[model samples]
Target: MGAFLLAWDPGGALAARIGVVNVQQVLTQSVAGKEATQNLEKEKVRLQGLLRGKKEELDKFAKEAQNLQLEIEQKGAIWREEERTRKTTDLRRRQRDLAREQDEMKRLLEESQRDLTERQRQAVTQIVKELRDIVHQLGRDDKFDLILDSTASGVLFATPSSNITEKVLQLYDRKKKK
Candidate 1:
């Protein structure tokens, strides 16, 4: 029992050096992250513009249809039955065309949204990959035995001295600049 107690290093003299990193901080502060955000915002703006234009077009079509209906109602009483029927048929055909156009526009908007989401996901993935590489390099260069993500690890408390998040961000930005 005495020998076992002597051999045990309770002071952790041989324990691995631990490092803590705030991954969210690094992700939000890194240059690559900023660029990714800007790109996503630009895509969102462009998509919004397209959707707005389509909506305007739909509104115009609706107004035109309304105007045509009003005209038919005003003149139908004086016209022959054949003419009135022909005009009603034209209005129904135009309504169907308008519905088709509206459906197409909705489809286009959904597709654009999907495409934008995919692109944003890819960009975030790429940033995460780069961040991993940077963290790995930092650990190797600094001789860290273990680096843990504070956020993911549910670390409620850690001394500021043990945190390496800022260093990782600096290294990442420096490498990106090159």
Candidate 2:
């Protein structure tokens, strides 16, 4: 009760061939991966420097402010009554400025993280699409029913002959050259 077409279906052989192509290597070694890693490293270094500078500035300010407070405390109750209002105002101002600086740094860091994630996602999606297209072509050429990604599939082991890591890398390199 099954209908058969006149053309032959080489699904098994084609799927095996595509599997051997190993598109994961192609994506991992591609330019996108290199660029994403490079940019992320650069951002990481820049952020570290920014954090160090901010922390040092805050520490210096805190030390100087503490010394000023101690000087006022030691000077005695007579001068304290005279300058209490001005001292409180100055302390509140310093606290507010420090808080603002901390908040700004945190916001910038969060923005950088978001940007990095978006860039990585974009690069990955582009590479995956390219690999899928190549795999689809191979499948068409060989008449495969399905070409499964071993990484996303329930595959435990594949024989050396079944691995297409090198082939996909070569193809990727060729495409990059073009």
Candidate 3:
């Protein structure tokens, strides 16, 4: 409607019927989108729980190492030279082990997060593709000159009469039902 005009044709020779679609609305309201979102949320929560458990384990290990270091510091003066050296070496080894464990856990968590993000991205992309196809078909059937995503900046304002989002949603939901 007023989003854009047939400015090039002042004589009213070219009357283009443009349609708008609120893609974000379709994504949130559609059954497939809801299912995809729910699934992703579940996976996200599971990953968070796993990460929390691993962090707790690392925290416990770090606390144990700290306690051992404190013990050595308080008792080192009366200890034999060999015992002190052995304890110092043990502390150094434990420190290295802790560092390595933290790095490994960090890497694993990053990999898992990356994988989950990628999966969510791919799912959304597929859903968008489906919506695009439906929009295209709607355009063809209704003889619309152009179909714009109202969610995009290209469509600043569109008349309600021109928005096909509800129609598109109905069609999309029906398609997913099969």
Candidate 4:
């Protein structure tokens, strides 16, 4: 009963209405090449370095706090309880200051990363629109029934004859050159 309900309803009819392209390959090789890849990598490295430096500062603060804790433990017994309490309060204040700085740094880093991602997404979206236009023109020229992006769909095994990625890239490159 389950198999009967799940049987193919459209069969060969749906196959006639679809075509596919590897947009990932098209964008990598055609739209943004080695230069764009390198620039993005350099930007990533710079951002990482900034974050690392901030983390190092935080680590240093943690180390100072740890040292103060040790000092308090050693001096805690020798001093009057009120004197020990005052030193502990001072140490706690320092820790709170460091924690606030670390939190602000983390928030800024997250916001910067989000901004970079949004900008990259916008640039990719614009490039994809241009590629789509090129592909649509080619589809019209070839009278294709439909066009699909194999990369977006996670299609691993498309026949070379059926794939139009290279052709679209060629047209897109030519258009760019002109």
Candidate 5:
């Protein structure tokens, strides 16, 4: 114990200060991140409305086809053969139309989801890049020996005094505004 104390370099220990930051907080609190979230939400709502409209149109077609089928079943005994055949053909055509429209709707929904996901990914990448730059600058300006992302760094415990999340957020917002 005595030899260890005597050999210890106090200067090195004092120079190595650790800091923690919650990256999730920074991403959610940053102005640019908020804007991206809002944009994504707006796009989601638009897509949902479009899908709803398509569903309603399909429902109308389904109802009409059902009514035609019922009429054929109820009156086929008295109707001429040609009339019955024509009604059956119309019902089949409506069914085919419904199937085609359903497929189109599904394709549109998948495309919209893919587009939204890509946009979200791009926005997150941009925000992360900016965040890294800000954190790097903060580390330089504040003389931080090491700054860890508590959210991803698997830091089980850290004192509040060593947390720089709020400061990082402020700096990020300021930089974004500029």
Candidate 6:
């Protein structure tokens, strides 16, 4: 890179302050990240509970339909024609209701899961944007001419003095607190 730069310009390159950030590490270890993770987990659990309840209700409905079917099988032979027809109609109605309810439940679950995923994505995007801004702010304050995200950049080597993940994380946490 230095050779390429030298080839491009006759004059020698000038000294520039450079900093690197392990963005993934900062996001995982930072206070705001932890809080966001916890909140998402809690929401996930709550949604799981709601889906579980809906499943339980469906299961109960299914069991009731099964019992009615067995009753029709056992007692249907001895009943009058009209009574048999009424019981058969009732059983079919129950089956249809169960299928409809199951479909509705599936739709609700899918919609909820999609919403949760989108929310998570939005939250991460917002955090990344904020982190980017903070990185620029810190770079300016510290007189860094360049700041690179090691997680995304192809940077393979950086000195300890150039690594500023901790400082950025600390500043991020502080700003979030405010």
* Candidate with the greatest TM-score versus the true structure: 3
User: Which tens-of-lDDT digit does each residue in 2-117 have in candidate 2?
Assistant: 33432335564322243544455566676655665787778778877877887788778777677767765776466656587687567667777778877877887788788778
In model 4, the worst 10-residue window by lDDT is: 8-17
The total of clashing pairs for model 4 equals 0
The full ranking of all candidates by TM-score, starting with the best, is 3, 5, 1, 6, 2, 4
Query: Candidates 1 and 5: which is better by lDDT?
Result: 5
Question: Judged by lDDT relative to the true structure, which candidate is superior, 1 or 2?
Answer: 1
Which candidate, 2 or 3, has the higher lDDT? 3
lDDT of each: 0.89, 0.68, 0.91, 0.80, 0.91, 0.91
What tens digits encode model 4's per-residue C-alpha lDDT throughout 112-139? 7897788677667877898889888887
Q: List the residue pairs that clash in candidate 1.
A: none
RMSD of each: 3.7, 4.5, 3.2, 5.8, 3.7, 2.7
* Stretches > 4 Å off in candidate 5: 1-15
Q: TM-score of each candidate?
A: 0.87, 0.74, 0.90, 0.74, 0.88, 0.85
lDDT for each residue of candidate 6 in 1-178, tens digit (9 for 90 to 100): 9886765644545667899999988778888788878888899999999999999999999999999999999999999999999999999999999999999999989998898899888878888899999999998899998999998999999999999999999999999999
Tens-place lDDT per residue, model 1, 18-135, is 7999988887788988888898899899989989999999999988888889989999899999999999998998899899999999899989989999998898788878889988
| TM match of model 4 to true structure | 0.74
Give the per-residue lDDT digits (tens) of candidate 3, residues 1-178: 5535535667778788999999999999999989999999999999889889989999998998999899998999999999999999999998999999999899989998898989888988999999989998999999999999888856878899999999999999999999
Q: How far does residue 143 in candidate 5 sit from its true spot (Å)?
A: 1.7
Off by over 4 Å in 4: 1-19, 31-36, 80-86, 153-158
Clashing pairs in 4: none
Model 6 steric clash pairs: none
